[model samples]
Target: MASAETDSKSLFSLESYHVSEEHGFILPEPLEELPPYYKPWMDIALRVPELVHSHELRSHVNKMPLLSSTFLQKHRELRLAHLALSMMTMGYIWQEGEKNTAEILPQNLAVPYWEVSQRLGLPPIITHADAVLANWKKKDPDGPFNMQNLELLVRLPGGESVRGFFLVTLLVELAGVPAVRSIPTVINGVRCSDTEAVARGLEIISKSIEDMTDALRLMQVYVDPSVFYGIMRIYLSGWKDNPCMPKGLIYEGVQTEPMEYSGGSAAQSSLLHCFDELLGVKHEPKSASFLIRMRDYMPPLHKKLIQDISLQPSLRNFVQQQDCKDLNKAFDLCVTKLLALRSYHINVVSRFITVPAARARQLREQNHDSDGEIISRAPTALEERGTGGSGIMSFLKTVRDQTKDTLLPEASKEVKHHS
Candidate 1:
């Protein structure tokens, strides 16, 4: 485990990045005055628009406008689920341990439920029950029923069943919100690079789990559900690093082995390779990465059908020769990578670059450097040499000048005559 001091130093000392409001990156009301942890996560939220526009991600939100009323409805529901599920797991763990801290939670920590929620947001979702009902009513005035009627028909426990109901609804919403769309922002005070921010977020999540080991065991009732929630949140926050998880989940239904980041099924391998090349993320096929993968890895048959082409020697040849088997596939991959790049560029670079001249002046004080100005002034190897040095002639000149300056007039004249 990383020491807290080291982690803190890494985060706070990181180079500061600018945040953008023009691109849906408004500082949340709850986080403006708080510590830095929220900034990284808010940065994640700010990138969702690009995700929605991505060819790879368009299917997730194609039905609605980016962050429209429908999107927000899903977002609210997912956030609610994230909080409720985490809290319920904590409660279950507390009860299972007979309220004993030793058997139910990590040492040196008291708060559990909300703390975990703070660590994981509900995997951002694309659907909401209210949205669906509203849609049904608008399209079919005599719609068969509503969520309330459906719940009654199913005979689920009064409101408790909402979790399960929401679970399915959330999955439907997920079609609109790719696992990659809901990245978890590592909340900290550090000014880190993009890679560092992701690393810190993962580290915090891992630590939070360690701290909750005892609690996790006690929360048997909530284990599977919490795992489901945790797994999704984990991927949403770091899908690029945990690509295998989503890949496995999407293709194999569960993550069983490490994914090959370089190559595999021609369609997928090519896509993953492009994603890595464009995004600089090396996805590993780890156990925790499955759920997110499952969400994206449509089965071979579906992929074939979706591409609107019958598979034969041509598809293979296309993938091998052209480097992409189908137009839709290529389009999707292009969109995904482009959106991912745009998100990073906006969240990590534009925000800082946009800092007002006044603020930049204060930050650099004597330097008076804008972010671009500093970047432009980066040194080159050849520029490192001092102007006074070249070779023997330069050295000789320096020595002569010094000797002449240090000598008395008579001594210098005598030395010159002897020479």
Candidate 2:
């Protein structure tokens, strides 16, 4: 038991880790030299926070082409990833409490964000980009990518206090790896009508989902209601004004103009979409659907590829066959695990955010001035976002509920009947 504890501690030891100056997820180049078109916005986003609300910034973003010729002319994929990361980072810091903003973001975070916002036809604002980019790091500059290290870094935020939320995030990232690895195999299997190969991919994804849920259960011990709420107050310090919980992160320039959308974050969770494609789960026709519109936020190439793969008659036929029970089971397992995680989050939000917000309101009411000039404590932006007063918790809960309804009983049952 002692040895197991030691091993676990060493696995998360930061002394063994370092930021990879080269070959890190974020490009090493300075923000000053990239995508001349986005520099103006970057300047305003980094320096003049108030300027983002003005029409000038919006006008500047409006005039830029959706896919800048410069982006198409260069390292398209890498550049797109960089831009997405930067915009998310800027949005994250822009809303962060004044105290956490002192560490001026390195160029690694600045350049690509501005460039990507131009490409995606959206203003450079805080979104799910921050959540995805927050965990990128490496033990050695030249080392291969390690998901364990990424998981460890995520736990560093609130330490033991907010370990549950960070642990869930880590498990989510870890879960996506096998899904990503199985992509090529699944695609190739469909192309060749190899049901066995497709089955193999499904097995891997199912096991990964199970593992993720198991990992999430460990969060129960680490999550103390009061402590977790306090930690969130610190983490969400920057997201007061922006209450929209982004659905996915946009990696590619797909739209001509910014549209009111969610699901950009879903793009990061590649496994969920991969399941939809393999099982022929169509969420598009449904109104206000959580996962359907996520495709709009994905890069054009990726979105197109997923669409093409889904359209393959062989894959759909295989999923519909009675012999594909194992594949169907695997798909169901993934959905169940995801729902479990969402349920866990909902409970945590209720305890940490919803309840506290209600109490804070009660306290304010009780403290009001007798003379009708109501004496009150002005809540900080972070406090407001943290306490569920900003509508973030409600938005998140609605998305989760919608997803739960959309997937369970109905979709799973349909797939089973077809099989």
Model number with the top lDDT: 2
lDDT of 2 by residue, 1-419 (tens): 01222333322111221212232112222122336564544454333224333324333333433333344344434343444344434334434333333233333343345565566543343323233433344456466444333332222123455434544554555645565556556556655556677778767766766665665565556665554543334333322233432222232333333223232232334345655565554443332343444444443444455565566554445555535666556545555565565667667557655665565566566864523321112233333443312345655555455444434454656644754
Worst 10 residues of 1 by lDDT: 22-31
lDDT of each: 0.25, 0.44
Cα RMSD, each candidate: 28.3, 12.7
User: In TM-score terms, which candidate is top?
Assistant: 2
What count of clashes does model 2 give?
A: 15
lDDT of 1 at 137: 16
- Per-residue error at 249 for model 1, in Å? 34
Q: Could you tell me the lDDT of residue 136 within candidate 2? A: 42
The reply for model 1, stretches above 4 Å from the true place, is: 1-318, 321-344, 352-419
